[model samples]
Target: MCVADGGVKTDRLSPAMVDKLTFLRGVGKQFWDLTDARIVNRNITMLRLGTLLLLCGSVFANELTINKIEDAAKAGQFTNIKIGNIQVPAGQTLHLKGLKAGTKIDFVGKVTFGFKQWEGPLIKIEGKGITVTGSPGHVIDCDGKRWWDGKGGNGGTTKPKFFAARLTDSSISNLNVKNLPVHGFSINSCQKLAITGVNIDVSSGDYANGAHNTDGFDVGSSSDIQIKNCNVKNQDDCLAINSGKNILFQGNTCSGGHGISIGSVGARKDNVVQGVIIKDNVVMKSTNGIRVKTVLNAVGSVSDVTFENIKLVDISKVGITVQGNYLNGGPKGEPTGGVPIRDLTIKNVYGNVLPKGTNILVWVKNASNWKFAFRTLWEVKDKIWRRTIKQDSDAQWRGPGQCFADHPQPRATRFTFP
Candidate 1:
């Protein structure tokens, strides 16, 4: 019965398994004190104490129920196999790689993950203070219409990218991911991670639009990340901060997709996306509203960003896209003054767009100390605003009929466009 740091070595429990682990540790201390008790059923008492710790076995070990897929890939690392569920066996990959530190995974009903063509993630949650959860209409389903067929991940068929969480000080919440044959959640190198109320529904890939590149949370090189109250309807970027440092996207709700991004940030020389905080959030029929792509020559440096109280809708093209000649997916050629955006702050952002969208599009080659206080009340409809960097009519009313048109100029050695 040696259960200390080295954990699990069970043998002694048979007094009715020690009275069911003393009534399951008093119902796990009222389910860990209902995690701060807002109490609207607290996820139905955490799914009835995770189905009574999966039918009485997990006081802290032996509850595993991985129905194959190589016994859930050899039960990850097994630090006392506390409480795993994972019901694999439709098409195949349910990896769950190294998990150990304080493990607690769930999902018993609708956990299908078996489609294949290759290059998949299918489901791979690495460890470190892990705690993955699900069961409120439980769904991990990645049938993705048997792999969309619309050139996602480049050219069709090999669709498998479902969920690849590289958690650190983890906490994934009430998840309900769907139709993800392509990108969905690839949060990497997480530290103090807390993704809440997760719900990435690929709106049926918008029907004939065929869900190509379905990204919902592509954070990378994470730090104290906290993606809150999430709910994304994907097609592309709903939250893509490709490098991190104190990131926090709050009260989320993005639709259609290609909103809330912080870079195709410098392709990687230790890519640095600094203290970001996209607050309040809610972007609807998005195409681009709150973006910051930087990739041309690629190096690094996206600093202190803050987009506050944002709420855009129907933005069909550009509501706020800062560019550095991003490639492949738009912004064709010439504008690489090497990733240097600093101290940007856009506030009180309200929204609208669709009469040929384009509320603000700053083509950055380099920026510094920018502050836009979009004083609410906006209903953009081609209120065209473009910046190559030469703003001084007090930054031209800040937006909504904010005029500026001499684009493509910021490179006379950085700062001389007009």
Candidate 2:
């Protein structure tokens, strides 16, 4: 119930929450009588309202420590509930029915181990300014081996995404996510969100099973978000930023995934992603880096994005690519032209490559007025450009203006002079 020392109490539930405890008791007509309050005297109602207000004022008088959730979840008004030092069980979901401001939840132990296609998010928080953090060295073990046969979202075992949805003004940090059944985390409709200092290790899916598409962080329709100081070593896109404004992603380490992308946009359905910055991140041995691809036929505007100071090593394909008219190769290499890309910048990127026949340093199509600056583009055609494309001896083989030449498109050609 309480943990206190030296006149400083750490955690307790609100008294206003305790006042509502009477409502949870006494079933049938009495429950409705307290909840409905249709027949109560107006003066009595005013007195109860005043009492509730006073209780609320006293709720946070000391830090409200909640270790036992079975008792706290029973409270109706979840305003100002501070959850600290709590160990939750498997197959459990904490629902923030109607949370209010100043609600802080601290996760004390490892998350419940899960397998099978259970309806989840292990933890769900709502309302304003909610903070859910795990103790240092905490883990959310999905027991992915149970579901990972390398076919993640492509239909192996039904895998539930970690943190299925996050509302606004929240932070979930300091945890290790190991072997997710499917996608790791999906951030939804949360403004001013910060997901920092977390690790997602789906590498076990790489060899033991066929880990298909285990994307790390999927951001959709949210704003003012920052995902930094994190590591994602999985099979698919490290960060799939769908639709948002003013996003900041930096100081992250990623490998074995699509290196930091924006879009697959306007493909399934289009949305706007504006004012994004992907800088100072290390991408290792990925399929691509600093990419923005749109659906072939979908309609949307993705603009005002900047990628700078990105480092890549042993990557297999495009060093930096922005293409709109994209078509993935199936058994027959079919092309699907569904979406378009626009208004992007990729700068200060230095990397190695396969033969020019294998990797495209920078590729673009079906976008307008995009800029590529300070790119030391590399191609190993004769293994010359891999060293210096602008060498005096290689001038004959270099495209115009060294690396600043327009992409031989009718429109971009006007920007570069012969």
Q: How far in Å is the alpha carbon of 300 misplaced in model 2?
A: 1.3
How far is 84's C-alpha from truth in model 2 (Å)? Answer: 8.1
TM-score: model 2 vs. ground truth: 0.69
Best by TM-score: 2
Model 2 scores worst on lDDT over the 10 consecutive residues at 409-418
lDDT of 2 by residue, 70-146 (tens): 74564335543544445445456655556566666655445555344664665566666776665554466666677
Top model number, lDDT:
1
RMSD of 2: 11.5
The TM-score values for the models, in the order shown, are 0.34, 0.69
